[model samples]
Each structure stands twice: as C-alpha cells, then as structure tokens.
Target: MVGFNGKSNSAKQIIHRMRRGPTLPDGGVNFECHCVSHLVASPCGYEFREAIKCQKAASEGELEEGACADELMNFMRCAIRTECFRSW
Candidate 1:
C-alpha cells in the first residue's frame, strides 16, 4: 500500500532568498530612508537584528512607551559609528 503524502516537494523551494543576512522584512530591511538586503553581511547587521527582535517580542501596548529602546539605540549607534549605510 502507498503512504499518503502532504506537502509537495516543490513546495519546499525557496522562491527568493534574501541577500545572506539575518531575517529581514518581507522585501528587505527598510530604514524608512532605504531598504537593505545584504545586511547580515554588513558591519552593523547584528545590531539591526537585535533591535528588530526586541521590537517583535514586545507586548501589544508595551511598544507605546518604547519596548526595544536599548536595542534600537544600539543599532542606531552602530549605524552612525560605522557609517555603513550610505546611499549609493
């Protein structure tokens, strides 16, 4: 007897992988000013990831005052200090 299979093998395919980085937003990491792809490969990638993670973990109302303030601050500082995000 044949066993029943659920998802198709084709379903496991990665349509479009981001530019080798920590999980970024659907399109990319949007800084309001711009969106980045190869962030994980960049200098300030870790800082950005930490900030996003903190923000995502916050409860519904907790973000009102500020949930990931420290993480966000750290990311901002890294960005400024490294000046890695310059417009091409």
Candidate 2:
C-alpha cells in the first residue's frame, strides 16, 4: 500500500500499520521504514524487529500456520502498551 510519504510500503513494513491513520494533508506511502517516527523511536522496537524477522523467514505455509504469531503478538502488545502504533 502507499504510505504517508509517497513511498511504496513493503509487505513487512505494512505489518506495522495495524490500523490506518487519518489521511495526511497529502497522500503518502510506507517503505522499509514504516513511515512513522513513533515507531522509529518506540520502546516496542525490539518486538517489532523480532516479528519482522520471523515474518521474513517464514514460508507462506508457515506464515499462514502462525509460525510468526508469537512474535507478531509480542510486537502488537508492545505497540499497544507503548501507544507507538497509534492511528491518530
């Protein structure tokens, strides 16, 4: 999907946007960095990294089978607790 910076969001980065934020004054895109500085400096950064690494290594079957589920869950919890993935 397109990010808030006009960059094409990589599949991996797209995972960071659990929910879409309000539209920017201008349209944009998410690339390797996932766009938001909130995430860049998040306390959840480590969890996010672990999840992405798991996602990248999983095969389609493994991914669908939830091989990365734990990692993703950890990241999600961290994101929520830290409010680092806010849509606002």
- Index of the highest-lDDT prediction: 2
Tens digits of per-residue lDDT for model 1, 10-81? 422423322334435574434432244366557988887787767767876988887889898998899889
Q: Work out the TM-score per prediction.
A: 0.59, 0.53
Residue-wise lDDT of candidate 2 within 1-88, one digit each (tens)? Answer: 7888999998778765654542232433221333544454588867866776677668999998879999989988887887865778
On TM-score, the candidate that comes out on top is 1
In the order shown, what is each candidate's alpha-carbon RMSD? 7.8, 11.4
Worst 10 residues of 2 by lDDT: 22-31
The CA lDDT of each predicted structure is 0.65, 0.68
Error of 1 at 28 (Å): 15
Which regions in candidate 1 have their CA more than 4 angstroms from the true location? Answer: 1-8, 11-36
